[model samples]
Target: MSLFAKRIVLGVSGGIAAYKAPDLVRRLRDASAEVRVVLTQGAQAFITPLTFQAVSHQPVHTDLLDPEAEAGMGHLELARWADQIVIAPASADLLAKLAHGHANDLLTTLCLATEAPITLCPAMNHIMWQAPATEANIHTLETRGVRLLGPIEGPLAEGESGPGRLMEPLDIVAALNGAAGAVPSIAALSDKRVLITAGPTREPIDPVRFLANRSSGRMGFAIAEAAARAGAQVTLVTGPSQLTAPRGVTRVDVETAEQMHREVLARAAQADLFIAAAAVADYRVAAPADQKVKKTETAQHLELVPNPDILRDVAALSDGPFTVGFAAETQAIVDNARRKLTDKGLDLIAANAVGEQQGFDVSDNTLQVLWSDGQATLGPAPKTQIASELIELIGARLDATG
Candidate 1:
């Protein structure tokens, strides 16, 4: 039942991962999908059109204007022929072009002409993948209902390892099988306003130095995306992180804990739900040196002061939003989370154990969610999947309370 008889237009973009496109075509056909391959000029640098043509058993389309095919508008013909369009090894350049609606090439032009759903499997250097511009482009694509499969974490072509690898050919086929039947859920948060805080806030130590934590903000960003998909008007107050704001979500970037606190409280009144997910610094320098502190032979002592309790403050508001808080613990996870839940007067709290191996700067997560009456445990799965499940739970609990 996986992509059987589906007409898939396979777009190959420029990247080292282009070498895997032929295998991807084979896998798609193995799942009984009819695949037509398209190649960009840059893609031709890594793999030839003939190679794809041989594997797909179909002519590989490359040019925007063809004397033989343009007489009948070949791009339009291919555009109208597809049931779905998939770009494997979607380069950062391709993404930016698509995001900005550039149709100078055959593939981009076909994408503009097609009415079928589009899916992208991004592959790039780890640093490039995490770039702010790339993040914004991805966010734009997601909002336009373009699905993304992966830029999963793994070894890159340059011998560095991070989240820029293309999903394996077999894995892509398996995922497409699942994606083929997937439908958007009901708009559970329709007309609702959601405020979420994410990432680790910094506390300035000197002009060039700062105290920060390992929070990458992936979990919070995923939750924001899930909430947006559920039709909520989401405002994300995020600390400094490489991840961008999700599509259809408004992003407010801050650096210090105080800035995050200010932004969250400013918008908390208008929100229907609030998720305090930021790993904010518990303390900051009482009076940090105005200039860079010079290294000396003697020890340096910094006077630290407690930071504002953001979750508790928001919860204490009169007729405020239904507040949810997150607790990342090293030991006594549940006990600490439960304490925070009650102490902060939160409607619900999600807690997880964090150490060198789990949580913090990672892509996957496991959560123990607790409300006053009941509790649930969510998977040690990809953060995106966890976010989806967590959102479903949030929507159900919100309904129950009302």
Candidate 2:
């Protein structure tokens, strides 16, 4: 779960992407969010209110003029009920309506009446999205403080494609989770420099061969995003990965374990917090061929040498930052994590089980956080939720120690 449970009202508008509503509701619930669905009349053309009701385990609101609810001003009631109003698949028509403050429908009426922040995930044809009126309407909504998620440029439902496709349900969830209840002007980690290492470091055996792990860097990148959200001056020292850097983060890209170590050591003194989340290869080929080695008739012997202990070196610094380490073990998680806490002189260690289908290349992860005095288990959920909880925990610990 996130640090706080959110009461989210998900409004689905008329678009081909309305088919994704069920999965969006499921994801919100999976993150421990309370979800209620609001469907527009045109949305019923694609998905039924009954289908949404089944997945949400609640009645879906459709009619703007329901006799029973209208008796108590239903739109106003729902507007007050939401902590945030997220309209996914927000069509061009709906955007225009909301921008002009039209209350012809339930969703637009709720947008007008709600004090909660409005987030729109615009989904429409590229031509409609690029029109002068639509662009002006979006700017109008933005000026009124409405947050726009994405119409990420990619393939579209229409044969001709440009921009204006709705983001994936998971990406929407991540953006919502990142923005929910976020204070507009709090200096939570302000001016505090944070350096985080993420992803899998490659150790080259030859020109065409290298050693690496399955680390996707989702958790580490989530941490960087969360830290930045709290107003930290964040520097993400990352290994080679396809992931983009989080907004407002400085990414220092590196490849080999030696490169990561050099960067971390160089940046440690200036950081207030140092998180070693990269799955650096522990060993590398001692001697390598200048070129790609060809298959030999005889059995080949390869020498291996240990890589530098990046975390241990950082912890041993005279003026080191609050050092954190990750222990990915197959068994005896707590014991191994506790041992590493002392062995590496880490201020904190987050332990997880690796191998099989868990923890390495997945979007969701769990963590057992171990410190000298106590421990806390943080998962069985998405990495985004876990990351928020972890940041909150770190903030609390820093306060306690201070």
TM per prediction: 0.72, 0.77
Model 2 TM? 0.77
Query: In TM-score terms, which candidate is top?
Result: 2
Tens digits of per-residue lDDT for model 1, 212-330 = 99998988987887787677899999999866565578999999989988988999898999998889999999998899999999999999999998999999999899999999999
Clashes of 2: 0
Query: Please, what's the RMSD in Å of model 2?
Result: 5.1
Q: 221-328, model 2: which lDDT tens digit per residue?
A: 888877776668899999987665664689999998899999999999989899888888899889867899898899978788999999999999998899989999
Best by lDDT: 1
Using alpha carbons, what is the TM-score of model 1? Answer: 0.72
